[model samples]
Target: MEPKREFFPKVKKTVMPRPYFATEKDVLGHRGTAAAVDAAIYGSNWYLDKEQGLIEIYDAGAAISFFNLLPRKDKYEKEGLYLRLKIAYRTTENANVNLRNFSGNHVTLPNSLTGAMYDDPQTYWWVTDDLTLNINSIFSGEKLWIQRVDWEWMSKEIIYEDELFAKNTILYRSLEEVQKLYSEKELTDDDVKDFLRDKIKNDDWFAKKCLVMLREEQLMGEKLVKLFEDSGLEL
Candidate 1:
């Protein structure tokens, strides 16, 4: 087996729209367009970021090669949407491709101006490494997302597949890949303190809540117990 290359951060550059879906006619006029794009797989309005050029939609058939994971069935009984996305990156002065299959299962699209329009289904659940692929080349990279239905919805429980692969490789998060791309910056005591402070300051609502919980527990003289509890958590 070839030595697996560690994933590097995906470099992003803003660009003008490629004019793929510039008009309603482009979506409705073309024959086989809906099927090609898998419109039925995800509702028409399920993808709301087209106006911002933040997303690009393509037919599922046009993206078969990018689907590194097992393909979901065609039927869906759930209420939410699903989709496949191609995320592109630029590194080494060359654009690289990445694949992500997004089954919009129980995912909500953010309507706020500052919020992202599309949410990855994998974010809520664990994803296997095989579902992610990095393609190095020119012509811009694309992160492909494939959305389809499955059998787990009837139970209302999230599906967790132990053996997951995208593009024939195990899926890894950007954080996991960061270690290989950047040399670890050994931190001094002062640096560690500074980093912790910065992280606490910039943390999101949920993160801040956790911090507050920790502080509250410590203030109640249960710091040692809390520490022990946290220490026992599975990675």
Candidate 2:
């Protein structure tokens, strides 16, 4: 039998009507289009600045990606929003396919945005890795967000199959990959101070990125902890 053609689920992008307090000029050219599309899907006007940070809209959240840790890292960056996602297909005749099979059981990738799946339904929760999300890639006023990753990337073969790999639950993105997306330049002096003073103080999510920014900026030791002081918290 001939192999079946691959199919992928898709979302659409279309020109949005002029948003209130927003114009093509307000959003950075191509980014305006992205924001418009995102707004159409998410039901809120969204945009990003030059440094890839969120300007915010009515309590909307930022878009963060642990890009380097994504399954097909090279593909995502090269293709922009175009993701060629593949599902773990198992046919009874072919049990040795790429992904392990779970015959007579139900297994679905519950929250995977990139479609990483497994055969066993019992292996539900994905363990985490050290790869942190690029917190500054958030956008709201001028640019649309790239996708964000709030969960961890795990490998069952490493943990369940053998003792060859470390018994850790997560995988980490390389330093170079982290810098490319969440560059030091993304966090400005004011942005850093603001994040350290407010966002980090209030939410634990922002803390890791804040520490990365502080180290990147060379705000070492006391200088680092001192920034936290004004936020009315300790590092």
Candidate 3:
């Protein structure tokens, strides 16, 4: 008897939707990461497209960090615009983060200015989450019309060293796990640290990675002291 052929299951991608949006101008402050994104999204271009919106950046290994956005408002913000535009990628896009870079439509957002993208409400996006594993990698698809939001993201210097570093070890988890652990309920500092510390002892690689994270500016002054205090580790 012949076996039945089945299609691959939809892959759940790890996407961080909370991002600070700025006109292609304000984001210029992060020239280094911005350039890398530009290269990944637009090949080798001396200038960013007027319609492009520089989204987020992860400066960990300086490996991959950037977003390409298409514009919607009447005028696009350039390098010298005294304009303030905030935006957020709405996560309520159907079932999951739709893949496929085909932002050529206009969508309405709640508060922030409206924008255009290469997406349609009726059609299912072709790009699957499997392509972008959410490990601070380059995302070069769908110029989205993200709505501006008024939220302060951690300083760009934050590096998110922990998030990136954790991937190599057993601590790595899909966004679903993150959502379950923290999103659904509250976790006390001690409880959180205790849980993770226990896992650390079980996973040697995870423990080693934590040490590296500490070395990367994570240990110093109060930060160093706090690590021990939080983990209930003496000295």
lDDT of 3 by residue, 33-73 (tens): 22222323322212233454433322111212133332222
Q: Candidate 3 — which residues are off by over 4 angstroms?
A: 1-117, 120-193, 197-204, 207-235
Judged by TM-score relative to the true structure, which candidate is superior, 1 or 3?
1
What do the candidate models score in CA lDDT, each in turn? Answer: 0.34, 0.34, 0.35
Model 1 weakest 10-residue run by lDDT: 26-35
- lDDT string for model 2 (1-235, tens) is 9799877789578988877752222211111112111222233333444353322222233322222323332223421222222222112221222211112222222323222333232323221232121122211222222332222222223346575475665455565864576454655799877766897689887888867777864655456556787569744
Error of 1 at 13 (Å): 46
Q: Order the candidates by lDDT, highest first — what do you get?
A: 3, 1, 2
RMSD of candidate 3 to the truth, in angstroms, is 23.0
- Which portions of model 1 show Cα errors greater than 4 Å? 1-61, 66-186, 213-235
- TM-score for each candidate, following the candidate numbering: 0.19, 0.18, 0.17
Clash count list over all predictions: 25, 12, 11
